[model samples]
Structure formats: structure tokens, C-alpha cells
Target chain A: MDVFLQTLVAGILKGGLYALIGIGMTLIMGVMGIINLAHGQLMMVAMYITYVLHLAGVDPYISLFVAMPALFLLGCLIQRFLLNPLLKVDTILPENQVLMTVGIGMVLTEIIRFIFKSDYKSVSTGYSNATFFLGNISFSIALGISFIIAIAFTVAMFFFLIKTDIGRSIRATAQDKDAAVLMGVNTGRITIITFGLGSGLVAAAGCLLAPVYYVFPDIGGPFTARAFIITILGGLGSTVGAIFGGVTLGLAESFGATYISMDYENIIGMTIFVLVLLFLPGGFKRLTKI
Target chain B: MLKVDAIDVFYGDLQVLWGSSFEVREKEIVVLVGANGAGKSTTLKTISGLLRPKAGTIVFDGVRLDRLPADRIIGHGVVHVPEARRLFREMSVEENMVMGSLAPEARKKRRETLAWVYELFPRMKERRKQAAGTLSGGEQQMCAIGRGLMALPRLLMFDEPSLGLAPILVEDVFNIVKRINKEGVTVLLVEQNVRQTLALCDRAYVLENGSVVLQGTGKELLADPHVKEAYLGL
Candidate 1:
């Protein structure tokens, strides 16, 4: 029972960071109706940024503000210059956009490899290995701080979507493009802004993970797969569902790593993904109706 | 006032409107009556800047609207309540209305306009917190129209506002349109419900095969022998 409780606590903490990453991907998916294959690459870029800042004596947590806004601008540029132009292209398959993102992921990986030479890099602060105990469960200090920050960001995002004017416009565009236009929403601009917001959120996750996870050029590929699974399990465009999906994946991975062979960690995630696809086709969003 | 002058609109190689021309004078209830595939909806879309005209221009008030984008057109007070309601399904009825007032000009007056819209359709007020997709068809139509009113439109256009409603609900919808027009908003309505729309509108235009074939006062067109044969089934 103690072991089980410990695993659960660790899973929930890791899940909070996963939720941040999933939210970014889901936001881009909801507004643009395209899977961003380069999403993990964007986070990888932020991790590198955080690592460099840490080497320069800046704290990893403080690097978040710099990494977020920088990635936000980068995201806007990609959407405006790369993605928006494709809307007018005459293509046989609409999957051209998805393919473009895959190419983008490759390009980003190669560029980072050229700069960093594929070395596994990590940022280590004083609290990176520090732990605290609550009854029988121990929690890593860094992960606990990350979890609290993630919850704060999620609550902030909810208020933004529900209370603000531009946030409502984003929801409107996701619902119906034509109706959004009729309602005076500048949808093209909204797409650019949504992409930026998505990137910023993922950048936050990357900064939070920098001290815990190794950063490398090719690290994006596995994280991309994980993000995709979370989005699919949560229902493609539902934000609330993404949170639930992330937590479920985190718990599954945690339990699998402990009870089963550690080598099967990813396999466990894949198995859950397949089962969810077969049984809950619409994902948790269908059940929650959000 | 709105003017569509000899516009030709196309979807790729297929032309939907050829040399289509019409006008809606200030504060007038103007109806464009035609069958499916007659380009009635296409005309509304063109005026709203959803589809650009291949050749020709659209003028709303004194401003040329043909070059403006779909979103910019709404800022000029030309609101198109599109076919099928097209309510944001996941959003609440109030949120849908709030979206309608997103433009800079409309945003300042949103509160007063929202109050007026709720007065026009009290049913919408009761369902304000409900998701628009869950509403009945008649209630959805009411919400759609209420949303348009929230934009503070000087020229309000409706595309088949009563398409799928029962007869009694259709009557209620038309009555609301009439009430809206009486409140000083110019209306350009597209409908296949010929007799009733003609009875309510001040002037009417008959469209066939993407072109305007006839135009006159509502009473004049209602009495025309050709209209009676082709449309009224007399």
C-alpha cells in the first residue's frame, strides 16, 4: 500500500507537467484542425534555451519567462509564414499540412544537432535531487514546484478562455470558422495568436523539465509521440480532457515502471493508447461533454 | 443601404452568380426569393465577403465592400446570419451572443444591444446559459437572430431563416423578422418560402439560375402571371 501511494504521488506530479505540454498541442489542434508534428521540437528548443541560460548562471525557473516569449514569437512566425500560406495551395491531400510539420520537426532536430552535437545535456540546481516526505510518500522538490506552477497556469488559462474577449474569439473560431468571421473575429490573426500561446505553454513545460530530464537534439521524437497520445486520449480538442489524459498516462507509466520491467514503460503507454482508441473513440471528452 | 452591382462569383471554375445585381434601400425589408441552386445563399455570402466576387463590386452604404475581408465587413455593420443558424455548438447561448459583439464598434455598445436582443427574443434570455447545440430548432433560429442583433448591424441579412421549422414556428420567425425591421434595421432576406416572404417584404427580387429575372414591389410580383406559374404553382 505504501509503495502504491508513493507511485501515485510521483505520477500526479509528473502528470501536471504532461498536462502543460498536452494543452499546447490541443490548443493548436482545436483552432487549426491540424496535428502539429513539430510540437515536441518546439519544447526541445525551449529546453536547450533553458539549459544555456542555466549555464550562464540564471536559474531554470527564471529562464521560463525568456524561453516562453521567445518561443511565442517563433510560433507566430511559423504559423504566419509557413502554415497560413498553405491554406491557399492546391493540394490533393489535406494531410499536406501534417506532412509539412513532420518536415519542420526534422529540420528543427537537424539544426539543434548542428549546434549542440547531440550531447545529452541537463541542468542541475540545488533542489534537483531534494525530496520531502508526506506520511509514507516522498516528493521531489523540483517536481512539486513544477506541479504547483502547472496548476496555476491551467487555472489562468481557464479564466482567459472564459472571461476575456480574445479568448472567446478563439473558442468561436474553433467552433465554426464561417460563423466566427460573421461575428467579426479576425480568424487569421487568431490562428497566429493561438499558435503563439500554444508554443508559450509548451516552453513553460520544457523549462520545468530541464532539471529533471536530459536535453538532446533527438529527444523531441519520443516526447512528440507522448504528446500525441495524450491529445488523442483526452479527445483531440478538449482542454479539460487533455488534463485527464495526461494524468492517466503519467499514472500508467509510473505503475508500469515500478511493477513491470522498466524497459516496457513506453510499451505500457502504447497499450493504453490502443485500448482507449478501441473503447472510447471520442476519448474522455465524449464522456465529459466539455 | 446595400448595393450589389452586376457581380459574378465563382467557386473555382463553376460560376455561382452571373451578372447578379440588386439593391436594398435604407430601412427597407427586401426579400430575395429563389429555389435551391438559384444562388440565393451565394448572393448573401458574396455581400458578406465570405466569397469574393469574380467581377463587379458590392457597396454597403457609401463604402466599397468587395475588397474587404469577411471579418472586416462585419465591422462596417453588415452582419450575415448564415443558413442553418451555425451557432457555436459548444458555447452557451449568451457566449454566442457575446461573440457577435466582438468588433470594436459593437463592443462598446454590447450591453445595451444585448438587452435589446433579449427583449426581442425572451426565449433566448431563458436559455442564455444553455449550450446552443442543445436548443430546439426554433430556439436556435431565435438565438441566431439575437446574435446578429448584438452586432448592432445597420444592414442585417438572413439566409433561409425559417428553413426547417414547423409552420407555427415559421410564423413566429417571420413575425420576429418583421419586428426587427420595424426597429430601423435594413433587412435583406433570402428565402424559399415565397408567399409569406413576399407578403411581409416591401420589395422583392426573383432569382433564377443565378441571375435576377424580375424585380418590383412585393404586391406587383405577387400578381405577376409568370411568378404565379413558376413559383406559386397557380
Candidate 2:
């Protein structure tokens, strides 16, 4: 029972961070109607930025602001310069944009490899290994802080989507592109902003995870797969569903690592993903209806 | 006032409209009556900047609109309540209306326009919090019109607004269009419901196979033999 409780606590903490990453991918999916295969690469870029700032004696937490905005700009550039032009290209397959993103992911990974040499790197903050006990469960301090911050960001994002005009415009664009255009939404620009916002959200997750997870040029591939699974598990574009999907994945991974084998952690996640596709095809969003 | 002067529109080499010319004077209820493939909707789309004209120009109040994008076209107060009532399905009725006022100029008058839209379509006010997709067909059409009104448009265009409604609802929609026109907004309506639209509009244009075949006052065209045979089935 004690071991079960400890595992549950750890899973929830990790799930919070996963929710942040999932939310970004889901947002991009919702607005652009294209899965961003480079989403994990964007996070990888943010992690590298956080690492560089950490090396310069800046705290990882403080680098969150820098990494997020930098990523937002980078995302805007990617959408405007790379993705937007594809809308005009005559293609037999509508998945050309998806293929373009895969290419982008490869390019980003290669560029980072060229610069950082694929070395496994990590940030060692003061609380990187610190732990606290609550009853029988022990929580890592870094994970706890990240969990709180992730919740804050999620709440903030919810308010932004519901309360703000620009956020409403984003939702409108996602719902119907032609209608949004007729409504004077400048939807092209909205896509750019949505991409930026998605990148910014994932950058926060990357910064939060820097202290806990090792960073490397090739680390993006796994996270990219994880993010895709979460989006599918959560429903394609539902924000609330992303949170549930992320948590479910985190718990599954945690339990698998604890009871089965660490080597099967990813396999466990993939198995759940397949089950979700087979059964709840619309994902948790169909359940939540949000 | 809006004037579309001899514009050609194509959908990937298959021309949908060929040198179609029409004009709407200020405060007038102008209707474009045609069959399914007569380019009625295509004309409205060209005016709204959804599809750029291959040749010729569209002028609204003396400014050329042919070169602008769809989003920018709304800034000139040319709001299109598109065919099939393309309301944001996942959004609430109120959110849909709010989206209608997305332009900076329209946003300034959002509260006023929203109140007026509610006044025009009180059912929309009651269903403000309901998701638009869940609404009945008539209610969805009402919401679509209400959304267009929220833009505070100088020229409001409707594309086949009465396409799928019952006879009673169709009458209600026409009355609403008349009421909207009386409120000082110029109307450019495209419809296949020929007799009723001609009866309501001040002036009417008859389109056949992507070109304007006839144009005159509503009463004049209603009496024309060509119009009666081609459109009114008389």
C-alpha cells in the first residue's frame, strides 16, 4: 500500500508536467488542424536554451521567461515562413504539412546536434535531488514546484481561452476557418499566434523538466511521440482532455516502471494509446464535451 | 453602396462566374435570384473577398475590394452571412456573435450591435449560452444572421439564407431581412427562392449560368416574361 501510494504521488507530479506539453500540442492541433511533428523539437530547443542560461549562472526557473518568449517567436517564424506557404502549394496529399513538420523535426534535431554534439546534459539546481515526505509518500522538490507551476499555467490558459477576445478568435478559427475569416478574424495571423502560444506552453514544460530530466539533441523524438499519444488519448483538440490524457499516461508509465519493468515504460503508454484508439476513438474529449 | 463590375471568377480553371456585373445602391434591398449553378453564391463570395476576381473590379463606396483578402473585406463593413449558416459549432451563440465583431472597428460598437442583434432575434438572446451546433436549423440561421449583424455592417450580404427552412421560417427570415434593411443597412441577398425574394427586394438581378441575364426594379422583373419563365416557373 505504501509503495502504491508513493507511486501514485510521483505519477501525479509527473502528469502535471506532461499536461503542459500535451496542452501545447493540442492547441496547435486544434487551430492549425495539423499535428506538429516538431512539437518535441521545440521543447528540445527550449531545454537547450534553459541549459545555456543555467550554465551562465541563471536559475532554471528564471530562464522560463526567456525560453518561453524565445520559443514563441521561433514558433511564429516556423508557422509564417515554413508552414503558411505550404497552404498555397498544390499537393495531391493533404498531409503535406504533416510531412513538412516531420522534415522540420529532423532539421531541428540535426541543427541542435551540430551545435551541442548530442551529449546527454542536465541542469543541477540546488533542489534537483531534494525530496520531502508527506505521510508515506516522498515527493521530489523540483517535481512539486513544477506541478504547482503547471497547474497555474493551465488555469491561466483556461481563463485566456474563455475570457479574452484573441483567445475566442483562436477558438473560432479552430471551429470554422471560413466563418472565422468572414468574421474578420485575420485567421492567417491567428494561426501564427496559436503556434507561438503552443510553443510557449511547451517551453514552460521543458524549462520545468530541465532540472529533473537529462537533455540531449536526440531527446526530442521520444517526447514528440509522447506528446502525440497524449493528444490522441485526450481527443484531438480538447484542452481538458489533454490534461486527463497526460495524467493517465503519467500514471500508466509510473505503474509500469514500478511493477513491470522500466524498459517497458514506453510500451505501456503505447498499449494504452492503442486501446484508446480502438475503444474511445474521440478520446477523453468525447467524454468531457468541453 | 456596392458595385461588382464585370468580374470573372474561376475554381481551378472551371469558371464559376463570367463577367458578372451588378450594383447595390445605399439603403436598398437588392436580391440576386438564380438557380443552383447560376453563380449567385459565387457573386457574393467574390464581393466578400473569399475568392478573388480573375478580371474586373469590385468597388464598395468607391474603394476597390477585389485585391483584399477575405478578412480585410469585413473591415469595410461588408459582412457575409454565408450559405449553410457557418456558425462556429463548438462555440456558444454569444461567442459566435462576439466573433462577428472581431474587427477593431466592429469591436468598438460590439455592445451596441449585440443589443440590436438581440432585439432583432430575441430567440438568439435566449440561446446565447447554448452551443450553436445544438440549435435547430431555423435557430442556426437566426444565429448566423445575428452574428453578421454584430459586425455593424454598412453592407450586409446573405447567401441563400432561406435554402433549407420551412415556409413559415422562410417568411420570418425575409421579414427580418426587410427589417434589417429598414434599419439603414444596405442588403445584398442571393437566393433561389425567386418569387418571394423579388417581392421583398427593391431591385433584383436575374443570373443564369454565371452571368447576369436581366436587371430591373423588383416589380418590373417580377412582371418580366423571361424572369417568370426561367425562375418563377410561371
TM-score of every model versus the real structure: 0.99, 0.98
Model 1 chain A scores worst on lDDT over the 10 consecutive residues at A95-104
TM-score for model 1?
0.99
Candidate 2 on B124-206: residue-level lDDT in tens?
Answer: 99999999999999999999999998888899999999989999999999999999998999999999889999999999999
Chain B vs. true chain B: TM-score per candidate: 0.99, 0.98
Q: What is the lDDT of residue B79 in candidate 2?
A: 93
Model 1 residue A72 CA deviation in Å:
0.7
- In the predicted model 1, the residue pairs found to clash are none
Following a full C-alpha superposition, what root-mean-square deviation does model 1 have from the true structure?
0.8
lDDT of 1 by residue, A97-202 (tens): 7888899889999999999998998899999999999997899999999999888888898899899999999989999999998888899999999999999998
Interface RMSD of each candidate, angstroms, one decimal: 0.7, 0.8
Give the runs in model 2 whose Cα sits over 4 Å from its true position.
Answer: none
